[model samples]
Target: MERIILHCDLNSFYASVELLSHPDLRQTPVAVCGDPTSRHGIILAKNEPAKRFGVQTAETIWQAKKKCPDLVLLPPHHHLYREYSRKVNDIYGQYTDLVEPFGIDESWLDVTGTLHLFGGDARALADTLRRRMRQELGLTLSVGVSFNKVFAKLGSDYKKPDATTVISPENWREIVWPLPVGDLLYVGGAARKLLGQYGVDTIGQLAACKPDMLEQLMGKMGLQLHSYANGLDADPVRSRFEKEPVKSVGNGTTFPQNLTTRDQVRQGIAMLADSVASRLRHLGLYAGGLQVTVRDPQFRDRSRQTRLSAPTHLIREVTETAMDLTEQIWKPPSPIRALTVTAIHLMEAEDTYEQVDLFGGSAATRQRSEKLEAAMDRIRGKYGSSAIAYGAAAPEKEEDPLP
Candidate 1:
């Protein structure tokens, strides 16, 4: 039997939530943006009115204002967003236990088992969900109903605020094949450009391509897109309760000023690595490898990764490794707009066994570092994150605070 999947996407999530409190801005052009003084002034989201004026998400505030001078900018309140997300997901749980959250504002529901209880109509159920969200939370969502997760997500994107689109086996080809190939899941900029080179601009073109040829072009991702375009996605919607293991922990930040010196770059890496290491320790995991990505002033990113001699969750070790990796891709006096430090090749603390280096005292040093950082974690847990931090990693002022 074909599985029934429904992808629910909250429309213009950040701006929509912000507008709830500013009801007077309902028909006005509105956007949610970060602080411009901090150089984090990007449009996080925009309402339909702002969209009509060509305001786009992630564009600089000045650029958006050029298009929509009347745009009302609002700051984000993440706590309220989280509260509403939980409430919305709870409502979904009332219909099916197989609820899988795709992001903070989107989810996938496998309703095949409980469709009969909800009148055996996926379209009706999707509309009901939209209605419930608006009535209960003063928010709206667009829902996509299909036989698979990928198509279901595509369906949700096919419409706008408070809408439902159904893609069935009988009509999927007609409804989906005509759309741009980039509309399919995971078809990012590089993939789209690659496909365009061969005149594969639409979903039908992608599906018509030989799978082996696609794999040759895009490796596994090319083949995956082919499957999605052909409606061959068989991936299951994992239940919310079924927690997936953590594969990696990473932290990144865009500084208010571009880093032009090695000292500034080191400080940035240390700050990010500290956060990554803390998260790894909190999860009772150790990183066997570390990756560093440096974004230049032009937004071009260069990344490098390295395997650690021994797995560790220590801040000092992670920071040192990240610095080394960053050095491989970046040099001093080159302006760095952002930096990311990722702890990869994770292993459970219990599963990780380290061998003593008989020729060196690195094992003893690691044990000491672990104890010191663990104490710092406890101090921060009780007094807050700002309570204790490495002097070298302290920011002059908080920049690009993460969500």
Candidate 2:
């Protein structure tokens, strides 16, 4: 049976959410992004009016202002966004327990068997949900209904304000084929360039290409591309509440110029390690393994990893492992481009108790470290992560923190 999936996405979420409090900002151009002074500070969100002015996410705030001088730039209120997200999720759950969060502003819902309860028509259900949300939360949401997550996601895009769209097998080809190849999920830069060779420039062209040609050109990703192009997405609407994470923790940066110093590379590793460590703490877990991914000046990417005898949450330990692995992993002297640290083999924070029996590590020491990590997180949560920096991180802040 063709399943029914609903993808709900808020319009220019952070900006729209802010507009709720300041009703005057409605119909105005607004963007949200990083600090104007920081290189990493780039536009993160641009509302519909601002988009007309050519403002886009990841553009500098200065550049965004150039595009729309009156553009309102709001700093991220992640906590506030999260609170609103929960409310939205709660609303979705009222319809189906299979709802999955795509992020702060988007989610997917499975309405396979429950449809009849609400009369089973995708269009009507979408309208009812839209009205209810507006009445209760004073927010606008666009919904896309399709057989799978990918097409439903695409259905949600290219929508009018406060609208819902349904894409199904019958009109899938005629409607979706003429759209750009990039319109299909996962067709980014390299994929586009490669597909252009087979005269596959649009969803129609790509769909017509031989499956073997796609597989030969793009490997596993080609299959996904083909399935989505045909409006045949069998992938389940996975519950976002699942504990298993797709990836543990990792970081990356683009540098202006290459670095000639070994110390510079080490400093980058330390900073990235700190980032990974912070994430580890957030999950109430520790890494029993580490991986360091490096990018050279020429854009070549490589990675190395180490398995630890026991998991540790100390930022210094992860940093040291990352630096050590980087030495064994990459040849030095050529200018370095980017560094990333990832932690894996994560076990719950409470899992430390079993370690004393297995490895003969001191239970008291383990308890103390866990307490210390929690306290540090608490302090950092209120005062910022840099308010109390680790010794290794002290030298790092002097350089660009974003990099």
Alpha-carbon error at 27 in model 1, in Å? 1.8
Give me candidate 1's TM-score against the actual structure.
Answer: 0.87
Per-prediction RMSD in angstroms? 4.5, 6.7
Tens digit of lDDT per residue, candidate 1, span 285-389? 998888998988666888899877778887777877888888888876778998999989899878777776322567667677778899999999999987999
User: What overall lDDT goes with each candidate model?
Assistant: 0.89, 0.78
Clashes of each: 0, 0
The residue pairs found clashing in candidate 1 are none
lDDT of 2 by residue, 69-107 (tens): 899877877788899899999988888888888878999
Report the lDDT of model 1 for residue 56.
91
**The CA-based lDDT of model 2 is what?**
0.78
Error of 2 at 154 (Å): 1.0
Candidate 2 to native Cα RMSD, angstroms:
6.7
Best by TM-score: 1
Instruction: Show where candidate 1 strays beyond 4 Å.
Output: 210-219, 297-302, 305-310, 350-368, 375-403
